[model samples]
Target: MNEIELTIEQSKIYNGVICPYCKGISEMIKSKEIYGKDYGWLYICKPCDAYVGCHKNSKRPLGRLANKNLRKLKNEAHRYFDKIWKLKILDRTKAYNWLSEQLNIPFDYTHIGMFSEKTCRTVVEISKRALNDNRRLDMDFGVEPVTEFFETI
Candidate 1:
């Protein structure tokens, strides 16, 4: 590509980012602008009123910029889904793989950050059901995890 074309492409992905909600260009700024204290960096779209955080020490977005409701859904999804691994029903990686299989999505696209609101709700439902069932688990105190039976949920 020519220099001008390359520059345009770079602008599209650089510190001035894109708002997934509005498709408008977002600007990278310190987290203090939104949070009242410097937590890290974020890409904010003022007109659309959306933002997303960057990876630690990097400008790459953790996920798409979304509205408030979607952010709340993501948090709720994490609350339910985290128990599968946090309770040692499966290790973190295997828990993710189980969720991927349940959703019929590749592992790469199965993150809560990447999920639609519907998908987040599904994760919450599935995770809650899986944990509550405990069909594969023995009566032990969350010590003996039967990873194979996560499929039953």
Candidate 2:
């Protein structure tokens, strides 16, 4: 019907993946194209300017290309999720495993980097709830809260 729909149909027929916003095939290019400094390569949808960084030392994309809004959501999700392990309530692997269980996805596929915007929002919500629950439990059980203890140099 629309130009975007037509492109999406064509993209599906091809081997390459389509951009979520513009329905265009993404291109792999150096990050310098966008950032003016070579951070690394990225899979990018040029028209939409949506992009995902590659894995270290490889061209493989870290996740689906994300626009500004999705990127913001992903950052928010990470901020909340990181606290679970940062507080030492759980180790990194265990924290991801816990998130996997909560999200009802396979542990191997449960990375926040690969999450959709809706899933990212879910992560933020769930992590906040878990943090609150942990605080309540700590209060009830008289457990001391763990926080950074700084000593004067």
Candidate 3:
């Protein structure tokens, strides 16, 4: 390829950074799975990346969109709610006392009559599990070899 062509190719591949998890540069892996159907970011390994050739006409990213959004939201919410959640464990009595006073509920500082402790506990446990699972993928490179599962059109 000519120098200009090489530069263009380099620019396209370098447009985005590599996956923090696997240290792979994001690339537009070719697919025959069709346009919208074959959508997604593919992080290629260093050098040629050696992605499987696609006979189909489509491609897709392996990462979950929801997980990305959740991470962003979690980071933002942590700035505000981290204290409350920490207080919840370090000084449950004090946290509940503050809640009781702020809400003007009939419950006293000692009694958590205003909230369903069971329900709250369940929600917190489930949320914690979800967060843990999500964090596991924080450094994950998602799926590799876009051509492996590329649905042939």
User: For model 3, where is the 10-residue window of minimal lDDT?
Assistant: 144-153
Off by over 4 Å in 1: 1-16, 135-153
List the candidate 3 regions with Cα displacement exceeding 4 Å.
Answer: 1-115, 142-153
Residues 13-32, candidate 1: write the lDDT tens digits: 43346666666778888999
Candidate 2 lDDT, tens digit per residue, 26-114? 88788898889997888878788788887788776666678888889999999888999998878999999899889987776677767
Model 1: how far residue 139 lies from native, Å: 4.8
Best-fitting candidate, scored by TM-score: 2
Segments of candidate 2 deviating more than 4 angstroms: 1-17, 141-153
**What lDDT score is found at residue 93 in candidate 3?**
56
Root-mean-square deviation (CA) per prediction: 7.1, 8.3, 22.5
lDDT of 1 at 45: 87
Worst 10 residues of 1 by lDDT: 1-10
TM-score of each: 0.76, 0.76, 0.19
